[model samples]
Target chain A: MSKEKIRELKKKIEALVIAIPRELEAYEFYLDLAEKSADDAPSKEMFMFLAKQELFHRDHLEKMMNDLQSQLEEELKKGK
Target chain B: MLPLKKLIVHTHHIATHFTNALFPVSAALITLYLITDKPSFETACYYSMIFGLMSIPVAYGSGFYDWRTRFQGRRTFIFDHKVVFGIIFLILASIVVIWRSYDGGIMYSVGLNKWLYVTLVYSLTGIATWLGYLGGKFI
Candidate 1:
């Protein structure tokens, strides 16, 4: 691949990495909402349900980052 | 830097909007139950509640799982919003269960407890909505 293409891929990987932290924050937010509703049964169940999704997204992103790192390393090796 | 900033700006703007929508979606589902007074509505609420609660539990679990399995330490942050929001949702859920029980079939019976639960549902929904705002900032 050309230098330009490799550089663009690197930028994309970096952006994906940055996004992981925000996803974590969103997950925590759902958790907080669920906790607050513990006094009420209905809301508690719902919030907990939604909170799990946030965690799923976080896991999804983390996996994406790991994959990206491996891909970047492989590409660099090809350039050698 | 400039393009990244623009992307973040756009993303935040969209997230705030999406989070805001959760309130009305939940409220509308609840209102449908209140208005129609049917068992189906009750089922709908049940589904929503179940889905909502799963989000938090799964998120926390996955976060820990990632940390332990990946050996990466990038999932910690300001947790005030999470703690408060979790408590609020729990309180609301309790009120909902009681309200569900209060009514014979679906809608609440004409009683003091009905009114009390209604008031709580409204209050807790408001809290949930605000927490969405805080979440948007962090996201």
Candidate 2:
């Protein structure tokens, strides 16, 4: 629980905080494309696929944030 | 100030799309390379797999995040299926990348390994489609 270690953990959590919504937005953007391309089967399928990937990315980021939070808590508890 | 998860999720829409797009593209490229026996298509397929393999962690990470926050880390059937298949997808993609990298002539060789290599590459698309379908269920 050194200061630098704590700082590094904080930085990662901060980055994940910034990333979560962007991932969600990407999910929505691809979903919109899928909807718009309904007439073209291939295009629609590709767009829908892309949208799912974005959702997956958002979920991944949230997991990272949770991990960081847990690590920080452990560090803080050790320090005290 | 907006909370991190509350901010617009539209930002940084780059690498994951490339990651998501490239697997299927690689599958298609390999299909053509098999049919035409074109070196260029095979090379393209190799590069696509490399890039696609690189971006998987990002997609995997973000998907885990969504599951935790949206679903409260609940162990539902779809999420469980996604987790299992997603890991398989990751492992399979890694195998193909390593297999091809170690032996660049894999596809050209005439053997079970070559067909397995090709079959694994094609399965990346199948897994991606399945993963996508699971993600759709979440929506």
lDDT of 2 by residue, A1-80 (tens): 58898888877775565567567768878888889998999999999899899888888888888898899889999999
lDDT, candidate 1, equals: 0.58
Q: lDDT of each structure?
A: 0.58, 0.79
What does each candidate score in C-alpha RMSD? 19.8, 14.6
Error of 2 at B12 (Å): 9.9
TM-score, chain A, per candidate? 0.86, 0.95
The C-alpha stretches of model 2 lying farther than 4 A from their native spots are A1-80, B1-3, B6-17
- TM-score, candidate number 1: 0.40
What TM-score would chain B receive for each of the candidates shown? 0.53, 0.88
